[model samples]
Target chain A: MSHDAHVYSKSQTEYEYTRRVRREAMRGQVTTFAIMIFLTLIAFSAVAAGFSEYFIVPILLLLAAIQVVLQLYYFMHMSEKNHGMAAFFLYSGAILGFTLFLTFLTIVWWN
Target chain B: MDFNTKYTPQSWPDHPEQVTLEGKNKFLGFWLFLAGETVLFSSLFATYLALKNKGPSGMEFSTQTLFELPLVFVMTMILLTSSLTSVYAMYHMKNHNFKGMQTWLAITVILGIAFLCLEIYEFNHYVHLGFTYGQSAFSTAFFTLVGTHGLHVAIGLGWIILLLIRNAKRGFSLYNAPKYYTASLYWHFIDVVWVFIFTVVYLMGVVG
Candidate 1:
């Protein structure tokens, strides 16, 4: 309650501010957690539903991609404001990985 | 551990874990390591995709029979829920709630152990089903990719256990805050890889 307390000493206002940020972050986490579970369910049901392999494969991969992004940004806290370098390296690595895979798919053949 | 608790507003911010110099470096460096791990896993994933089902096509012990959806579903849920529990641990960390953080981390570690046991069972089941490694290129790739992931989970379990034991006495301080934070990040990365394994390796293996 003292205004002239130590500079780094926890003030009522600072406590409220931190609490509010954490509360909002928790909401984001809960929502994404539900969405991730839903996505996983959809992935499982798509297979169980016995659709054409052609139809199921791409859809399964797409859903997995979405879940990966969600896991990275939401649960992993990659979306936070100060994570620029992390995001850069992550996307760069992804792009490089995809490129390598694409090259193999284009060139590698089976008899 | 010489935890330097004193700080000014200029040094400590809303998030104490990330406000220190070492914390900032550790946070950035761990993510970069994870980025490289992404590439590593991707290469393994591509190898698996190319080699899956390439083994002479007529074997009775096909992937479909080998993959137990119910078991995989349970494993996925357990790992996913563990990720959430680690989030709660980090949440408590940000709030400076030491006991809350420790409780959630303990829960996370327990769930991780459960997942590892299930993986061991799954591998045992596969071997019993006569799908041992070296049967074919497909089998080799499958075991390597998934087994690597299982190894990561095992290592993560050990990492958490060591951190919990070492830090239990010290509690939350700036010196150890980044240590706990990075451990959670590693745990989350393991869960992320499992997401792909569940979908790409298990679900798609069953479907396609």
Candidate 2:
């Protein structure tokens, strides 16, 4: 609310440091968007050429995977050194997800 | 809705201690969500492949007969641009620029609506050519895959509208920041899903 820049006392310097760190955290979201744009164009081309359906599916899937990682690493900031254990729990869902897909596909295809 | 419950608190620290438990949990929770979404789409993708070659009356009325590139190209661009704008919004949020974030998010929302219109038009054109979803398994799969993604877009539009309205008065704080963050994540997630939908549903149908 104050028009003037609020100068921080040395004792309360952590608040200023926190604000700066938070600012850095936000800027990294841009890279995630850049990768998303690259992936989207590839998707558009696949839709355009009308020739790469089978090949394109996997490519797009891989890009989705990459974007997922991008979101986690950048936006979510989950890859910090202390959070390694938590990463396993997150990846466990990814493993379970793959299992679910393969199981459902097999049953449907075999039936 | 004032989301100020203890479970969903009124505010949180803009930056917390390095090993804060809550932030770690949130990060993992979102990852799990992305994983679940992956499985959801994979199942849809599998169903689509099974039905791709199955056309009407044993004759080939599948993707090749129905898919159009020009319209799809424009839709693709619309979605891609929306992704860029949402990123800009997030960038502003990081810098504590609430107005810039809102401005960008508004643009992203409009682009999302435009893409939805393009999809609707594309579907109508396909149906006019006798490629309706009820026509066959292929059409069923086609409609389900793409339609599900469309539904996501619709829901996202509604979600962003709520976010815009709710946050209009309240600027960027820790509580609202994560709310915006997750909403954008969902938006980007939908855009990514469409990428696959375009490939597996439209491209494959035309080629195979």
Candidate 3:
């Protein structure tokens, strides 16, 4: 309830545990950053290569999707525990957004 | 304001931002707000996709003609790097290193400003080429979708600047940890949106 309510003094075991967690997190961040940069490079190159629209479009979207996931999980820390509510709302919103996209593609644009 | 029992912890082993109750609420509420934003942006994207390239006769410009890849590419890199910088800020926040967090945040803000400036210049270039918002349906949708994103970046820049100034003297406390955390989350969300924009709008336009 208080700011100091949770004790800050950590035993050796707790300190090691925190250290390990942090090390893993740092690794994840570095790896994710590298992959995201690579993905962006691929996306740009795909367009620049002058491939057919059919070939480039799908690949671009797929790369973008992967990059977004990396951004959410690694950068935004959404993959960490205690984020169930956040993940739930995000997925729900994504589904709804997809449906909206479909409606426009199928009905609004066609008409 | 109970100073006696509210000493800053020497270590934050558990949840750093959620050490206090306010952080939990802010974290939850900010996610909900982002959910709404997801839908908000999706609707705009859908509208833009549907209406894109549907301009009336003699007014239609091919996506390749309207977009220049080099400029957009630089802007994308700027925003993406900013996202990574914010992640570093959050890492420092969890470690209870206020100076480290502020340094990374300052870097993030600078990167964000650079991106916004490039976007502005990109828009100006387009207008000079006569791709005004009222020029066509595609133009309108383009501006609305990308402009919405630009507005988010501008707002984020202002938000981070204000936080930096306001918290300069205060440093990191349980009271303000949530504020910084939520702002970083917002910045990451904007980056996520830009990823899609680059893929769907600029890349797709030029390639498709």
Candidate 4:
């Protein structure tokens, strides 16, 4: 069976509007990148400044969590519509992964 | 429509990557694969965390002394920038600018190569300092964890390069659009893993 994809060309104004919208989205992505860089800087500086391990470790992990969320939602487009199934699969994996972390850290350390 | 159906920017669908049955299936299936990958990496991370700094008696090497922050910092920046470049490439793809997408992807490949080079240098430096793979339990765990990530980076670079060359002659099409989109998604996932690596392994290592 053949699938026929109908092509409908946009008018000049419509094309221009779509282009502008894409450009705006790109700008937002760039801003997200900048924030990731800033977070990296703070993580590095916090360690270099010789802060208490207790204080620095949590902050570092927090920054990493924030960065990963941004990467997932923005860069990976998980924030977009029609991603319900995708989100479900990913979060399930994430929950299992978190369980693994807790098990290893607690059980292995205790033993 | 035929897989080879041609279209100008004006005729191209807004979400060309997901416009067809195959594209939609590929999109969902790839995310499932990514979810599995997350589980795989989590296991590795767990193993590394448990075995970290646990070596034979009188062992000298540890995370604090072995890792150099400056080198890791630079590598982080390069990889982060490369991720954004791939985002730019996708933006160009959405705009149906084939040349623009290719150029940005080329830039991304270059940056990826630079990151790989730094990683090689870092590994070699560690080896010279008596940190070989079989040195100790800690060394094994460290190498296994970070080396797996390095392998992922190498694989991602190869995948993107092959896509760039194979599709060099073919402009944007519904068939190939999902391919590029998935490749970028994988690349971003690599960056996500690195974020955790730097924090859990490098940063925490330094802190302790």
The prediction achieving the highest lDDT against the true structure is 4
**Off by more than 4 A, model 3:** A1-6, B1-9
lDDT digits (tens) for residues B1-208 of candidate 4: 5577888899888998888888899999999999998998998999999999889898899998899999999999999999999999999899899999999999999999999999999999999999899999899988898899999999999999999999999999988999999999999999999999999999899999
lDDT of 1 by residue, A9-99 (tens): 6677877776897889898899999999999999888888899999999998899889989988888888878889989988988898888
- Candidate 2 TM-score, C-alpha based: 0.73
TM-score of predicted chain A against the true chain A, for each candidate = 0.82, 0.69, 0.84, 0.92
Tens digit of lDDT per residue, candidate 2, span B1-208? Answer: 1223111111223332211344445655765676677777777877777666575567657566778766776787788678768877876665556789899999999999999998898889878887777888878988898888899999999999899998798765435666777778778778767666665566555555
User: Model 3 over residues B1-208: C-alpha lDDT tens digits?
Assistant: 2212333324553565676677788999999999999999999999999988878898758687788899989998899889889988888777777888899999999999899889889889889888898989889999999999999999999999999899898866667878998999999999999999998999998876
CA lDDT of B170 in candidate 3? 80
Q: Highest TM-score, which number? A: 4
* Residues B93-187 of candidate 1: C-alpha lDDT, one tens digit per residue: 87777789899999999999999999998888888877889777888889999999999999988988998899897767778888888999899
- Candidate 3's DockQ is 0.63
Candidate 3 per-residue lDDT, tens place, A1-111, comes to 444444557777877787678768887898899899999999898788899988778888899989999899878888888889999999999999999999988997567
Candidate 2: chain B TM-score against the reference chain B:
0.86
DockQ of each: 0.43, 0.22, 0.63, 0.75
Q: Could you tell which candidate, 2 or 4, scores higher by lDDT?
A: 4
- Alpha-carbon RMSD to native, per candidate: 3.9, 6.4, 2.1, 1.1
- Scored by lDDT, model 1 comes in at 0.84
CAPRI level of candidate 2: incorrect
Q: Which ten residues in a row have the lowest lDDT in candidate 2 chain B?
A: B1-10
Top DockQ model: 4
- Number of the candidate with higher lDDT, 2 or 3: 3
Two-chain complex of model 4, DockQ on C-alpha atoms against the true structure? 0.75
Candidate 4 regions exceeding 4 Å error are A1-5
